[model samples]
Target: MSRDDKGTISVRLVNEALLAFTSAALPAEQLLHQLGLVSVDLTDTDARIDVADFSKLWRRLARHFDDEFFGMNARRMRAGSFAFVCRAAMAQQTLDGALRVALDFFGLTFEGFRGELSRSESLAEITLSETSNVPPLRAFSYFTFWMLLHGLACWLVGRRIPLLAVELRCDEPDYTDDYRVMFSRNLRFARPTTRIIFAAEVLDLPVRRSEQELHSFLAHAPSNILVKYRDTTSLASRIKAQLREVPAEQWPTSEALAQTLCVSGSTLRRRLADAGQTYQAIKDQVRQEMATLWLADASITYAEIAERLGFADVSSFYKAFRKWSGTNPGQYRSLILRADEPIASRFP
Candidate 1:
């Protein structure tokens, strides 16, 4: 779509996704025409489509296929990104050892996003963030990258530990059903950020694929695969989750938490210091997270969530949610739920 009408999905991911969908059978021209575009300009990586015409193209394609065009794009990106991650992971001796390789080398295959990986005694979270200006497709691309990471990790281990949770920063409707079908997990919408949360134990799963096999696969890997995690994780996700459980007024202080963890306040400060986190950092995280969650839940009154979150009132809550997610809670929830319904149903 035109950059103005709606953001175009990542060109690289979109290309790779489309390639996988056609099994490399569809020609470039045919694919563009199918999307209802008169032509394509691949020379410029950030390609544009006629947004006004997208619906027509999408509908025409939908008539011939049972699945939605966007869904097909999601599936294709998932497979291609999965293959790229598996190959990278196979290059390392241990799952933990290979994380850097997975993060750094992913760029060689995919573009348009970055990721950050962190480890704790109980959990390891890989936060995926969109780096492109293409809002329309960036969220989908980010989701595809996340699905690839989770899906391939499970596939490579020959077992599914599943994610502890999948969080999307976008304030869209409940695509939880589609997300569940794709990632096989509980999905949270209007989260402060996008992430795939899993028990650290999953990182211990052995890599079964051989390097030679991995090398062969990478040789033909598409150019659209994404490779690095951003610095979005740190304390943001944890803080946000904690906010959901604790009221803003009652939120724990960094010192109080340090005592609970049986450490000195200074020590607690030092740890978070090392990680580039702080009490205020956590507070902001919680605020953003709760705002998103409250917005997504149609059952929850805005005023109730606002009071719980320690906002002054409904208007304050509304202003904050808008600032965090870019859209009011109502609009975000509607978009996500509608987009995700078909995908979610597939799992059932």
Candidate 2:
């Protein structure tokens, strides 16, 4: 991990970790100490943590439960329990078939949970249901299952699955905005059941991975699933991609980005709202990412970087950078470039 890996993660990341420990009652101070995330403001919805530290926090919380499902308000899934299911999935010929195997395995293994698939001519749905035997699913647990299944489906098909929407039975949480980073913006809460929707056409896609790839994929396990999608269909992803395609004179305005997608400003704003972002928020994310890479080049002046990111002037860019990283570009540059690079990764 580089300095880039040092989050300023969404505070929801910590709250999600709490999902894995929902059944336990650990002292908050002791829990933070174990995770080395004492600096984290647990109550601050706007807070962020170093990515490396967040991973540590996750490991600490998960270990306490000794259950991979993280006590998801249902059953405690034993660590390494998913491997057998993956092995069964690899024996199938198609994604649909693999999913059937996974569904069967989960149904047999988990007492209060179920994995189901329902399809029509143009749409497909994978629903996760909870019976009365176990506690209700937490929002974090539901999100994890969605990510895990979605990630595996993509990896198995050697392509991304652009989800149309995600349905959650739980009420919206304090970290509603963070959901944008996880899934497509068309999220619906208070749904009858939890499910992910996509095109039915992908049902027949052949499984592309082999046992060797499966081994590597399993090494990361559930953590590997929590990744941002680069789908060409995703609004945020498309916005980021378009921001890179245009001239660097200044970043695109809300109207410009909306025009690129062949949508009205109101429509664009409505879509982004579902993903928990504003146009300016998307611009900030894109600009900060590009700016960080540009700033790493000491040969380039800050003014030049500002121009490249579409800032009217260097001052505005500097102010935006502070909001993104909590420090000025100069300070961030020093932390990132590291005059003498070390051999070790910032992550454990």
Model 2 lDDT on a 0 to 1 scale: 0.66
Clashing pairs in 2: 7-50, 7-51, 9-49, 250-310, 251-310
lDDT of 2 by residue, 1-348 (tens): 112322245776676776444435665555676656666667776666754565566555556666656566445666565677777887888999988888887677666667788774455677776664334566777876766567677777877676655767678765655464556555666656667766667879998777898898876644455543332225776676677666656566788777878999999999998877787877676676677667656899999998888788989999987776445777656643442343221112
Task: Name the best candidate (by TM-score).
Answer: 2
lDDT of each prediction vs. the true structure? 0.52, 0.66
Question: Which candidate has the highest lDDT of all?
Answer: 2
> Each model's TM-score, in the order given?
0.39, 0.60
For each candidate in turn, give its C-alpha RMSD to the true structure in angstroms.
18.8, 18.1
Query: How many backbone overlaps does candidate 2 show?
Result: 5
Residue 293 lDDT, candidate 2, scale 0-100: 63
**What local lDDT does model 1 show for residue 55?**
33
